[model samples]
Target: MIATPQSCQELLAHMVGFDTVVAYHSGVAEAERKLSDYLAGLATAWGFTVRELPIEGACGNLLIEHCIDPTLPWLMFDSHMDTVGVEGMTIDPFGGEIRDGRLYGRGACDTKGTGAAMLWALREYAAGSQKPRNIAVLFSVGEEHVQTGARAFVEQHLALLDWTPAGVVAGEPTQMQVLGATGGFVRWKMTTLGQACHSSKPDRGHNAIYDMARLVTALEDDYIGKIRATHPLVGNASAAITVINGGKQVNVVPAEATITFDRRLVPGEDGQRELNAVQALAAQVAASRPGMQVTHHQFESAPPMGTVDGGQFANQAVTALEGVGISSEVAGEPFTTNGNHFAAAGIPTIVVGPGDIAQAHTPDEWVSLEELDRGIAGYAAIMKS
Candidate 1:
């Protein structure tokens, strides 16, 4: 049913060949479809069931079930099937080239590597080396998009399974560090409305840009401090005015100004509380600047997750990692990832995988040949134990 370590290494190269980038849309998300095809093939070849989750009128998540034995519980090896942009990749993002022992490609380190390792580990379990503890290998989609993949899997597919497994090891690039936390992201757009007037006269009309500018400055000087002053593992929260635009004509004061806000919060900071914080800050700014009405609204919200300790999943993960010759210590990440979705569902989740997160989605993005092997062996130890 399965092969040796070399067989697994070869499979990692194959997965890297498919450009499972974050850019996908419409019915079967081009990238997801490609991944689905590859995964379906693996399912058939490896004797696993292939199930597709129809997200937003399309196949959003791909679940490959490896039921080595029905009597044992499960061990979920989760990896995302989506990547970021491939704007200026020197090597073809989908080349899957293994040069000098390193794989040069887009999603190589970000996740494809983890997926491959998980696959190989499952195969090893199926290989009957020692009748590996019940386990299931999952290749989730849309992890780079909106975390819809993990969310769907946790809600829809978990019930479909006969055994929910001992725990889930979400493979995201931990560089081998056990990740137990993820900072929250709250994105919003603020618009300022004012009466249009001739710029030269300055008396007959209002300047929306000026109003927005005041809000931005106040937010930077005041509100930014209120929210950004602290965090436990991820450091202090942050907010930045990334975009702003308000101009109708050279001589006219624009009647509307818009600004985009990027806010990151530490765990325990409620999403709504963050929104309220913005609203409260805007009210203060408006009070100081007459005719400056700032409206705060949320466009995106990723609830944060805290470091999980004292849980069965955490203990088992620690033991599994230790059994593999690598001990794991619980840690947190400053950025947001799909782990948040499952964490929000009260699932004890950790984001760990190969490759340095620093190289993720970068131009010359690449993963070390050594790390790939460690990831495979480490994951195998987890599933087998």
Candidate 2:
């Protein structure tokens, strides 16, 4: 079930071989389990207490604990094990080919590659005699879909892992930069109902689609102002109606219409506030037409958090980066992550990892070999303090 560091890399290649792209409604299985087993075995080899967090029957988070003197607080570095869907790629999607100083495949950048880096770091620290503090490494799942994996892990095991020493580095694509701020994520669906009628009786039926289009136009303009009023980081809180499908084949006067929203609220803005504003907009549109009803529902949500420029926990890692050749600066982003959940739960969390976000989820997604080395060294330095 376990292997040497040299073999660990090969094991990781096998882990990535399974297409573990988590769909919120779907789940992770073989690949994620192998990943958990690999970490669990390594943790056991290194004298750690291992706990498995499962997602829809699969190992979600493998909490590996290495304790020495509990006198000092512990350090935790967390990364997800799931990858986004493989949409486009030129080579073998699961090949794990390491050519030209880069690893090419689906999970290479978005996650599994980072998982390999963390495993390599664990091997490095486990072999060293630095007498590192109680280091807890968490490899979480479902980060590509919902925050379910980490959210569940925190709810079930945060009390055990919650130690107050350094900080929690949420390993993600940062191109080796430490992230300070993260965007909020939310999704809503709006529907309009109308009385069904024959195609020839169109005049008699209040077409739901025509009514929904009116609401969509209103949503894209005036209602978004509520979000724009409190924009930060990259830009204003953004919203787009990504999906709209109604009715059967076009012969009849369709009785129903619906639109799905993709909204990105910036950090510092309460997630509930955006929901309320969108609801208000729906109410306003519904009031205009009493016969055709309008309703909205929230499908997904993640809170936003600002960056910490100079906190003891935040600065420790920043300070460590400077020890190497890397200079540090705080950054705020318009993307959401489990960091939102960690920060919401009162843990100081920041984003850090190798590779570029631009390459994430793309076909043939890859990370430079140099970034992997950098990520390993940088992660090792963070726990060194």
Q: Which model scores highest in lDDT? A: 1
Model 1 clashing residue pairs (backbone): 22-83, 74-165
Residue 13, model 1: lDDT of 67
Report the lDDT tens digits of candidate 1 across residue range 299-376. Answer: 887888775454456556667788877768767777887777777776677778878898898887778778887788
lDDT of each: 0.75, 0.73
Per the 3 Å backbone cut-off, how many clashing residue pairs does candidate 2 have?
A: 3
How much is 338 displaced in model 1, in angstroms? 1.2
Off by over 4 Å in 2: 7-14, 23-31, 54-58, 160-166, 229-234, 307-312
Task: Tell me how candidate 2 scores on lDDT.
Answer: 0.73
TM-score each candidate. 0.89, 0.91
